[model samples]
Target: MDHRTQLEERIAHLTRHVDELSEVVARQQSELDRLSRRVAMLMAREAERELDTGGSIPLADQKPPHW
Candidate 1:
């Protein structure tokens, strides 16, 4: 094939690869956002639970038995 044709093919391949990577990144970002919201909700629930229990120190903040 001619040099110009080879360059065009390479460009097409690279463009497709970039597009695929962009899709993956977009999916990962969506997943991250979902996980972040879930974490925040869990934290809020835990805080509410702590308040209900009269403001006890959260278990997560306590030192382990081995400590």
Candidate 2:
């Protein structure tokens, strides 16, 4: 193949690869956002449980047993 033709093929291949990678990254970002929201909700529920049990320390502020 001619030099110009080879260059064009390489460019096309790279472009496709970049597009595929972008889609993968976008999917990961969406999944991460969903997981983050779930974690926050779970944390809130734990805090409410602690309050109902009459625990004064917020779960986040409490030190570990080793401390």
- Give the range where candidate 2 is weakest over 10 consecutive residues by summed lDDT: 56-65
| lDDT tens readout by residue for model 2, 1-67 | 9999999999999999999999999999999999999999998889889989999977956899999
Please provide, for model 1 over 43-63, each residue's C-alpha lDDT reduced to its tens digit, 9 standing for 90 to 100: 878877987898887765578
- Could you tell me how far off, in angstroms, the CA of residue 35 lies in candidate 1 after the best superposition? 0.3
TM-score computed on alpha carbons, candidate 2? 0.87
Question: lDDT of each model, Cα atoms only?
Answer: 0.90, 0.93
- After superposition on all C-alphas, the RMSD of every candidate to the true structure, in Å, is 2.5, 1.8
Q: Point out where model 1 deviates above 4 Å.
A: 56-67
Model 2 residue runs over 4 Å out of place are 63-67
Leading candidate by lDDT: 2
Clashes of 1: 0
TM-score of each: 0.81, 0.87
Candidate 2 Cα deviation (angstroms), residue 14: 0.5
